[model samples]
Target: MQWIENGDLSFLDNRGMNGFLEYEKAVREIIAKVRVNGDKALLSYTKQFDHVDLETLHADSEHIATAYRDLPGTFIEVIKEAAGNIRSFHEKQKPDSWDVTHADGSRLGQRVTPLDAVGVYVPGGTAAYPSSVLMGAIPALVAGVKRIVLVSPPQKNGEISDGVLAAANEIGIKEIYQVGGAQAIAALAYGTETIKPVDKIVGPGNIYVTAAKKEVFGTVAIDSLAGPSEIVILADDSANPDWLAADLLSQAEHDPLSMAILVTTSKSLGKAVESHIQKQVRSLPRAEIAKKSLDDFGKIILVEDYDDGIKTVNKLAPEHLEIVVTNPEQILPEVRHAGAIFIGAYSSEPVGDYFAGPNHIIPTNRTARYSSPLSVESFVKRSSIIQYSFEAMQNNGRKIAEFARYEGLEAHARAIEKRIQE
Candidate 1:
């Protein structure tokens, strides 16, 4: 990877969402078909896209049990540990409800309630991520979501990945379905004969799944329009090139479209990291995908100082940010946006991606500028509470009616007038 000086950082501002526009027409048709045909469309699409013929839309107890039996005990133990960490972290994020009473006996507050149901989508093709299951579902469970449904595409043998099923089982999630892509998103948003609509859908998927979520957003809440995974490292001479290179490859291996960028003050470090990346990627199982990603989207920027590097990193707002500077804490305060920040050489990005308890379902494609990682808050809704005493209403009703009248709405004024009269 050749380093560029003061390179154009404008790519971070664009989400690359336009790439999905071509899929929108087909995705919309799928959504419409699912809405009308329900289970039939889901089954047909499963066969068409995933090449799986499903007699049942959901995994039964026997299948789940078999999955558990088939998975290695060590994998089971690790998932349990990760789930515990995720649950503990999200438990701290659970919000409480409280009311404030005014002297006039007017009360106002917010009632934070868990959504009734939630759907988690786990991507499945050749790769099996039990990790996504834990990261996506544990937060909803922490938030007290009653019904947690998990959906993943089936293999050619009409079976969800055993690792995925094992993770879901480990989390005590029973509502597992063998459907995926845009069709799975549609079913999650709109109820089918077999699958009930969920209050929210949270997880990562392919472009078609992302487009489907964008389409059904208002019909049901979605976590975010997650784009390809990405990471940016802000480093100095103190940073280790080998570690930085490994961390960059982590995100690059996710997809060919994923981005791995480095902004640093050390030119030598940049060259060394690029050399390490080339050496390390050759050994990865997904070497082809990682190499393609690096060729297409990978970048290295040489900045004059930490100030310039920090400015560029904030502007890019990469999903996963690593601060491998001399004093990461000092540099951390300046970071305005990023899905998650890893500090120091020891705190590798994969630690948070798997076990450090923060949700790995983070905002990608510069969405870190506004969006946040999935958490308990994503699984709950807040309703405003307002109760005014008769005396308080009598004192304020006329004022409200006057304001409504100024806006030229007679009915709005009359409603306040009626309350005042009473």
Candidate 2:
């Protein structure tokens, strides 16, 4: 890890937005082929890119059932517990249709409705993440989304991972596709012969998949233009070095570009944490990936005081922020932006990632400054409900006409005038 006694935070301004522009040309071609050729194009790309040849793309009930049964009883129990937690959290977020009546008897309110269908993309190949399926699909289920289609890349043997399939079956998601990457996104946005288009797509993927989502956004809603995973730690003398190092490595192992930063008031604690990271990383299975991430994006900034650490962190606007100072809550009020805040040393990043019930599908690459984590809101649509009573219109029609006239909208003014004349 590189240490800076006192460094400018500008270097962290835009982390993951630059390199994907070059992949746009290739991503566009993939989308066009899928749009024109339908399932034929989808199958061809699946075989070519994923190196898996298949006569069929869909995973039927028998296949999913087999996958679910194949898992150990212990693993299944843990998944069930985690699902319960997630469902309970998102159930609270479900909104109801409500209306308010004004003194003039004018009723105006909001009607919240779930989208008809949603597509969830799960990354495949070297890694298999059952947790991701739970994080993305459970909220859609709670939002009452009627159809949930899951797309994942098949392995060299032309089979989806059992873990992913188990998670999907756990949530009662039956429409599963064994295709992934840009073509899968295209098929979801613009329906193929077998696969149907959806209202919105949510999940994480590589650059090609992200670019495809960006291109097809207007055609179908997307959660966000997600980038690499990231986390930032704000620690003081009270923080534990071993725990801090473990937390930082959890995010760093995600990708080579994933960021792990530390802003501390004590210089000695920073050095101790750095030593612990080096020792801990040596034993990790993905040590090579974590090592590259640390060398490229990892940082340790030693600030003069706690106030200085908080000020610098707001500028970073990390996806996950861990406040491990003397009193973590005291610093939370000053934290302006972050996708998720893990308070104190006990509240680690993985707790939220898996069993804690909060969605792990968080905005990355400094987008936490504006965007938010995925939730029930991502799967639902809201509409304004307005019904003006006769008396209310009669009382305000002239004022409404004059305001319309001020805007030079003659038709709008005349419409109000006609209503008033009635």
Residues forming the 10-long window of minimal summed lDDT in candidate 1:
6-15
- Give every collision pair in model 2: none
Residues 1-422, candidate 2, lDDT per residue (tens digit)?
88878567666655766887899999999999999999999889988898887889897568788988999989988898999999999999998899999999999999999999999999997778888899989999999999999999987767888889999988888899999999999999999899999989999999999999999999999998898888999999899999999999999999998999999999899999999999999999999999999998899999998788888888888889999999987899999889999998899999999999989999887788888899998899999999998889999999999999999999998998888856
Among all windows of 10 consecutive residues in model 2, the one with the lowest summed lDDT is 6-15
Candidate 2 Cα RMSD after full superposition onto the native fold (Å): 1.2
Q: Tally clashing residue pairs in candidate 2.
A: 0
246-341 per-residue lDDT for model 1 (tens digits) = 999998998998999989998899999999999999999999999998998899999988888888888888889999999888889999989999
TM-score of each: 0.97, 0.98
User: How well does candidate 1 score on lDDT at residue 374?
Assistant: 92
Q: What C-alpha lDDT do the candidate models reach, one value each?
A: 0.91, 0.91
Q: What is the lDDT of residue 379 in candidate 1?
A: 89
